[model samples]
Target chain A: MHGLVNRAIQSFVTDTYGPDRWRRVTEAAELGDFEFEAMLIYDDAVTEALLAAFCADLGRSRGEVLEDLGTYLVSHPSVEALRRLLRFGGDSYVDFLHSLDDLNDRARLAVPDLHLPALDLREEGAGRYTLACGPGMPGFGWVMMGILRAMADDYGALVLLEHHGPHADEGADDEADEVIAVTLIESAFAAGRAFDLGARAG
Target chain B: MIAEDTLAGILARLCPMHLLVDDSGVIRRVGPTLQKLRPETPMPGQRFLDLFDLTRPRKVGCFADLLTGEGKLGVAFRDAPHTALKGQIVPLPGGAVIDLSFGISLIDAVRDYALTSADFAATSLAIELLYLVEAKSAVMGEYGQLSRRLQTARISAEEQAFTDTLTGLKNRRAMDHVLTRKAASGMPYSVMHIDLDFFKQVNDSLGHAAGDHVLQQVARILVEETRQEDTVARVGGDEFVIVFDNLTDRPRLRRIAERLIDRLQQPMLFQGRPCAISASIGIAPSVEQPLVSPAGLLRLADLALYDAKHAGRSTLRFATPRPAEPAWTRPAAGKDGETAPPSAVSGRDS
Candidate 1:
């Protein structure tokens, strides 16, 4: 089945590009269930949430949308259709997704060892991009996927891509046992320092 | 390998659609959820930076961005170019930089009306809370900037208001304000005037540059000899005044003047080289037997200073002779010579 998917994708790319396109599209897949991919793409409701969090960063909202370009989510096609399927119900999902980006960014940045670069305009490209990775066990891939897809529909013209899969695995699984469930309040505060505590480094 | 259960849970929650290589700037994968969003663009595992400029550290290539639909959180991108907020970086314990971000969403009428009754009830509350927070954040940011600006202004005004830039002594206005405030409290006050002898000749011979050096050193000497509480002013090109308030006795004033003459007599070190500097000092007591206004006290000190210049350069004179006289002027006798008469010591007006 994996071979079949790869062949189908390669054939489609070949037909689409008379081998002239600089690159070809082929499936780099794992021996996982079809639904496994689906599950990986849209499954955040199961894990004991590391932190129940909500954040509202004002500066990014009015003045700028995102300050970190490195971790910024660039959404495209597949993301939009899923959003519609998830019953987002019109623009309500738009606002809800935007709010989520604020929340997600807050948490990612607060991680003890990550200082992602800022999202810059002088540096942003015409295409959108997002890093989607899941460390084999207890991966953040789903969360990354959630952000990427929601982002896709949010902008019709912009193209955001998430980098995910086995290769992208951060390999953080066996290192830690229990997942930490932070109070939604904690994640909000943790992430919203961009908003809370008002202007200080780190 | 990401945890199956956890990844499943988060994926169920997020429904993320795209992924990019952390390094090498490649499109590592794209989940099925993303494919449905856009019917076209086979974006799976495509090199993102391959087609555009991702190499430059801080530049914008997009004007508008967005992420929409359900299972999809309400994420909206802006139309403005992405200007990386460099200073907005928030650092985590291990050198992690947390950049600033916020999301804005479009309002849909159906969705607006479809919220659960409970969720609906909280709708206004949530929006109000959000607005309150937004307003608060704006105010806080502005407040921080304003605080910094005000502190800088205070320092600048203070610098201009209190001390002389060149000599670092109390300026005339500052001295007057302090002394006047003290004088109003009925406190005792005394004034001393020190003027360089033949200062004009020094300026004429060595140039104003050397004269400035001479003045700076004299200011240092005067400041060094006086009490911290006293006021000193370089009121004129070659004239300086010192006011000592709340002193108890005559011996103290005499001792201070003696010290002034003895120390001022030492050769001045101007601009890293030796130069000569000499002064005539006048002292007037601000005692109760015959009180004088600040201006009048200064005038008396000036007269006594004139006598010192006549006695000899580098001399000290006290206002003991012709006490209570409206115009106090008399020659100071150098211990090495006899006192000169009033006419002998009188100098021609410059």
Candidate 2:
């Protein structure tokens, strides 16, 4: 894995939880020094061990930790460039959802060595879309769900999202894919304007 | 909204400063944020390359070249000194848009650009890398200090181990080391054994402090009278030894011993009283007996010292090979104040 991934986990734990908590997690992981270089490559086990230790430190499941990391990716000041890149995807929430298929290519422009999972988006109906995530990254679907939620907020769109289990026949295979169904409820900006009008009238 | 208005809004929101230029290098547009930051530069018609200097991709000649280059480019504004920016150029319909973000040191970026934790992202690991380097530097500094202290302590311990505390001269251990090394080399050398004649009387009448004062004075005289190459050591109470390298001649050895005794006989003030002391010296020349070991040389000098004391105090004696006779026999003093019968003063026979 690239050092960027490890550093993100470090930033997430240090910024969200605190440096002390990060230190404890690293200690439990048996890592004497946890400073990672941005362009360097590290063993995949290092990231796995850190995630496991972080989960143990916070007493949370791996999915929950990944989801938190996803949210932190968009909101944390340190990753503002990534947020900007994500925001550059499109002008509207629906357009951004369609742009998910090109995320790997866009990410490669910044980090050539990055190997993100493939994404497939399908328009289900009016104000609805279905997203399929390829295999190889465990618990990454939850992180993506969190990012989608934050992206919806950024677009001023209220949304409803759901995750479905892998197909029964595909479950026996080593590479089982997961799916997420997204539905836009309403425009949050319009709702805010309505509230403003009500306040003025009162 | 018009397409241009949307583009301008995006640029103003995302970048602190930006530039839009045509293919002919004419400035087509300047972001409002940049206009606000640098109000002095002519915005609409000025050449973009004229105001900003390209610091990266050394071969780039024009703004169009920058648009086609790989990765980000570093640029500094001519009007705004010491401020740098890093950004990429995106090709547009007729020209290109240069999207720029503040390019500064990590510390300066946080202070001046208002960069927060979100800016660091997962891809930025510079802070943690710098922290590790600093920790290593601190550890190395502490280790260097510790090493220097240890070296100083070792030198002090070595000095104390081989020096006499009272007279500030080399002690018995230092003399023994020099003698052993010289003896093993089998080089022609000489040893002078000096015993203070009336040191005990000084201690008995004037107190040990007065005796110590006299010893200090005698030590000073010994150091002054002897050559720099000679090793003078206080081996015991009221007893001293001197080693001379390559000075085995009998007459010169006797002269040095006589001069040392005369210097010691000088009056030294101790507690408002003048105290007189003399030395009985015995000289053993290694050239006379090439086979003598360090221990054997010391014993021979001691035997000669006994002869000097018997002949009378404040005198010098030279050691010769011992005669074939009982080792306990004492030689009688002659009328000339020398031990009778040269063969009777033999050191090896004794």
Candidate 3:
């Protein structure tokens, strides 16, 4: 099962940029920070404005953009801008967040076989949640939900971290992280079709 | 008119019923009469522990799990009708299962059938040999799954062993591995040592649980501050060391430290109560001074950390590896935009 997951990840990487680029990325990861080539690109307000133009260019709704945290805008400028930041910001934290955001959008526009929908979040209490959802299309919705969760978790941790001391805002983030993790696991189950293994992946 | 005594002789050749299972515990088939007696739901997934209603599963095949199509998972039972049942299911290469008389009493049962004791034992032994051959093949079928489980367990154990049990964060063992690698890698890396300020007060005022929650919360923050490539380990009860690899720039490092301090300053809400938590961090820049060894790097980082503690909690201090070289600083906000440090590659290199 772990091998299956790894295969899925490898396939995703290969499909996105080809095997050569993936090999380079893995090499970079293994080499750590110093020996690797600088990969972050810079973008100030003007670049951000150019990137923002994509929102209107793509004819996206405010709800769509806001709800998805700017996942909808994927013009050449937006991707180029992100590529720049991903290369130079030197913040892998920010880069990962961008990668996940792109991944979310990538599934919608690029991956034709994928059939998953956005998730709904309901606040059960001050810090509780209820994902009022059913088993998705062969659990495709579930998989998307999980990927969303993993992105949030991995980046959220990277973004709001302290070197030492009493870590703050943990309670709020813990709720968020758990929701994300659960979504990922649910998606994994759905993707694996453990619920109904006999059915073909639609 | 015939009494039809020959009909009984022919009927006795075949057992009237049989119950069978695949080696993996899926209920494959039941004898014709019991087909409808079996539940409609699948018995493939249910583990042996949860399989049956009987207190313990006998090694023998008399037990059965009763589940329905509508229910989640369930169990049921039928009386074991003892017989020397034999059947063939060849598509499943392995020997077909016999639900009766494979137990220790098979020889005795055969003797009761009017066969001599030696004949019963000898013939039954051949059947047992066939079963053994089938059992060995089943074990082979399961080898891959077993190996994967063991590999997963080994990785999990390695991580657990290197973790601080209290906060579920990397511990000293992880630090040792990182420190060892830092010496070998020849890459410029920074060690930022951090110590919590006034943690004892929390333990004194609230309770150990409160202290623990604070530690857990901090673990969350430390993970956030470092790169996925970096190691964040709790080397002491209240001390942590972050190995920042791939030098971006000093300002970048400073920015991270500042962010860490600012985040920690905010009041922490733990277990329904708001508590104040603060820490002092010492930064040991790898490039500035040539480290004699990994131990020297640790000492320098420690010195920086101690300096921050002396400066007061919620503080950040940096130690340049070399005190003599002031030539290598990057112009963070330079006038001409000639970023002095090669570290500043003009933005967006991807």
lDDT of each: 0.43, 0.71, 0.46
Q: What digit string (tens of lDDT, one per residue) describes model 1 on residues A86-174? A: 22221332333334434324323222222222221111222222232213233344333434343333433123333333321233342
- Candidate 2, residues B279-307: lDDT per residue as tens digits? 89888888775666776777677778878
Q: What class would a CAPRI assessor give candidate 2's docking?
A: incorrect
lDDT of 2 by residue, A1-202 (tens): 7766777778888889888988898889999656665556788788877888888778887666777788888767776555555664554677678879977765565566767778899998887888888875656677788888877776778999887755322234427677889998875553211111001110
- Give one digit per residue, the lDDT tens place, for model 3 in B1-350: 32223422332223222333444545444333223223463433443224343322223343232221111222233333323222322212221333222244343333333322122222234333332333333333335555776799888897769888887777988888887888788898888888888777787788888888888888889898778988888998788888888763778888888888777767788777876878888787777777346566666666566556656568887774554433333233545643243332334211
| lDDT (C-alpha) at residue B82 in model 2 | 45
Comparing 2 and 3 on TM-score, the stronger one: 2
TM-score of each: 0.34, 0.38, 0.31
For candidate 2, what's the RMSD? 20.4
TM-score of chain A of each: 0.23, 0.86, 0.24
List-wise, what DockQ does each model earn? 0.01, 0.02, 0.01
For candidate 3 chain A, which ten residues in a row score worst on lDDT?
A192-201
Model 2: CA > 4 A from native: A166-174, A187-202, B1-350
Q: What share of the true interface contacts does each candidate keep?
A: 0.00, 0.00, 0.00
| Prediction 3 global C-alpha lDDT | 0.46
The TM-score of predicted model 1 comes to 0.34
